[model samples]
Target chain A: DAGVTQSPTHLIKTRGQQVTLRCSPKSGHDTVSWYQQALGQGPQFIFQYYEEEERQRGNFPDRFSGHQFPNYSSELNVNALLLGDSALYLCASSLVYDTQYFGPGTRLTVL
Target chain B: DQQVKQNSPSLSVQEGRISILNCDYTNSMFDYFLWYKKYPAEGPTFLISISSIKDKNEDGRFTVFLNKSAKHLSLHIVPSQPGDSAVYFCAVFVQGAQKLVFGQGTRLTINP
Candidate 1:
């Protein structure tokens, strides 16, 4: 059984540009959630996707969005990236709000 | 505002001893609590969890204790080893919500 997996171990983007990070949830999982971990900080919930629709969101702004496909894979998109956007983006998968399994995460560097 | 808080930023304990890390929460509505361990440049791995209805949950070398009256919880590791050193995060799950609120994490170091 493969665990949650994320693409592009690391990424670099310039200000005002857009970037998309991908995630494949663990096998037998259906829900996907995204989180952001800044330097010296804990991971903060960005949003959660279930049934191909965003179910709940955190304090993030509209610029942060996500999508879930039928296969339970997910993608996080950040538009008009700012310097503060630089952080480790983590993806977690679960079965209907149960215990979550996290991925290695994609490190986004906004220059 | 941070619902969960780990007051101690770091702790050092001698190997083979017990290491106790504490966490406090301000939200009474949080029904589930969890502890996650993270290594450098890696996502956090779930350690243990306790539901509001239970006061304690144990798994192998890890034990999580909850005091709902005080809104406090703790993770205790017995016979701490050097490999146990890592940043530990305490998280809470609100009822009817899929989101988890995390603390600023506590870095644990076990000296040999």
Candidate 2:
């Protein structure tokens, strides 16, 4: 069975630019969550999607948004990116209220 | 305020020795706690976890101890191997919020 998978292993963008990251959840999983891991820090929850709607979100600003397709794949979009936004974006998938398994993550570099 | 905290930024131990990693949280409402290990260029891999109702949970050579009164938990690895070296993160799952809050993470180095 395939585990959680993320697209575009790495990305480079400039301040004020926008970037999109994609993720295909693990097989048999329905919920998808996104996280950001800055240098020397742990992953911080961004938001979670279930039933094609965002069910929960973290303290992130409105510039960060996401979408979940019917197939359980999800996408994270960051607009007007800041240098501080440069970090590793991780995607995790799980069944309802179950243990989450994470993807390899996409390294976002804001120039 | 940081909900989950791993006070130790780094730890080093000789191979085949006991390695203990600690974590503390500020909230008492957190019912579930988990530990994850991450290597360079890879996402965190779930290690072990313990629920608030249980003080201890064990999986093979890995064990987790939770002290609810102290709002603290710990992960113990026996006979550490070099491959075990990585960054470990302590995370808490808020049932109401349905999200994972993570600590800053602790780097574990097992020297051979």
Candidate 3:
């Protein structure tokens, strides 16, 4: 089975612009979470979605928002992107109370 | 303050030897700990993990040890191979929070 899939392998956006990244979770998995990894750093939790609702969020601001569809696919939206918003956007999927499997990640560059 | 920390930024080990990566966490609420290996341009891959209740968990040549009293965890790879070289991240999972808090990763280099 396809583990977890994310779209737009790489993206370049200017400051103040908005960007959206997509993810399709692994089969039979219901939860999707987003993470941001800066250069030379580990992945930082952004938020998690369960049952089409956001269940948990990290310290990230509201500029970072997400949506999980009924089919279990997910989307991450960043409004008014700042240069600091540049990072690798990773999407992970898991079953309830199961280990998460990650996608290849979308490399976002906010210039 | 960072909840989890990997003191070593990188480590070099000879093939056929043991490679140990260490991590420490400040949050006592975390019940599960995980390790993830990553290569350039790819997402982290889940490795072995241990729960707070257990001190050790083993899988193949990789073993993870957790010391709850010390709030420390470590990953040991026996007979390390060149292919085992990658950036390893220590992550703590809270029981009900369902999000991973990751430490700054340690890059492991196994030289042949």
Candidate 4:
């Protein structure tokens, strides 16, 4: 079976710009969670999507948002991006309340 | 503040030796402890996990130990191999939150 997948392997955007990253959950999974991993640090929780609704969110600002579709695919959108927003964006999928399996991250560079 | 911490930034071990990675958490309310292995340019891969109610969980060469009273956990890899050279992160799952709080990763290097 295919594992979780993410799109636009690499992206470059300037400050104040907006970027959208996409992800598809692994087969047989329904929940999707997003994370941001800066260089030299572990992934930080962004938000989680279940049933097409955001179920939980971390400490990130409102500039960061996401959506989950019926097929279990998801998208992460960042508005007014700053240089600090440069990081690896990861998408993890799981059956509700089960172990999360991550997708190869999308590397975003905000200059 | 970082709720989870992996004090050691990196470690080196002989190929045949055991590698131990440690992690500490500030909260005792976490429901589950998990270990994830990540390679360069990739997302973390789940290694193993232990419930708060249990002290230990093992899967093949990987094992995780939890000490709730001390709010500490550890991952042990026996007979470390070259392919095991990667960054490892320890994460906590809090009930009702549905999000994982992760520690700064520890990079492991297995030498031949």
lDDT of each: 0.94, 0.95, 0.95, 0.94
Each candidate: chain B TM-score: 0.97, 0.98, 0.97, 0.97
Model 3, global lDDT: 0.95
The complex in candidate 3 yields a DockQ of: 0.85
Q: Give the fraction of reference interface contacts each candidate recovers.
A: 0.73, 0.80, 0.80, 0.86
Worst 10 residues of 2 chain A by lDDT: A36-45
Q: DockQ of each model against the real complex?
A: 0.80, 0.89, 0.85, 0.89
Candidate 1 lDDT, B12-108, residue by residue in tens: 9999999999999997878899999999978899999999999999999999999999999999999899999999999997656688889999999
TM-score of each: 0.98, 0.99, 0.98, 0.98
lDDT of 2 at B66: 98
Kindly report which residue stretches of model 4 are placed more than 4 angstroms away from their true locations once superposed: none
Interface Cα RMSD of candidate 4: 0.7
Clashing pairs in model 4?
A: none
DockQ score for model 4, please? Answer: 0.89
Residue A51 deviation, candidate 3, in Å? 0.7
Q: How does chain B of model 4 score on TM-score?
A: 0.97
Writing each residue's lDDT as its tens digit, candidate 4 over A1-111 gives 999999999999999999999999999899999999999998999999999999999999999999999998999999999999999999999999989999999999988
Ranking by DockQ: 4, 2, 3, 1
Residue-level lDDT of model 4, residues B9-54, one tens digit each, is 9999999899999999997778798899999988899999999889
What tens-digit string does per-residue lDDT give for candidate 2 at A8-106? 999999999999999999999999999999999889999999999999999999999999999999999999999999999999999979999999999
Tens-digit lDDT track of model 3 for B1-112: 8999999999999999999999999977788999999988888999989988899999999999998888999999998999999999999887677899899999999999
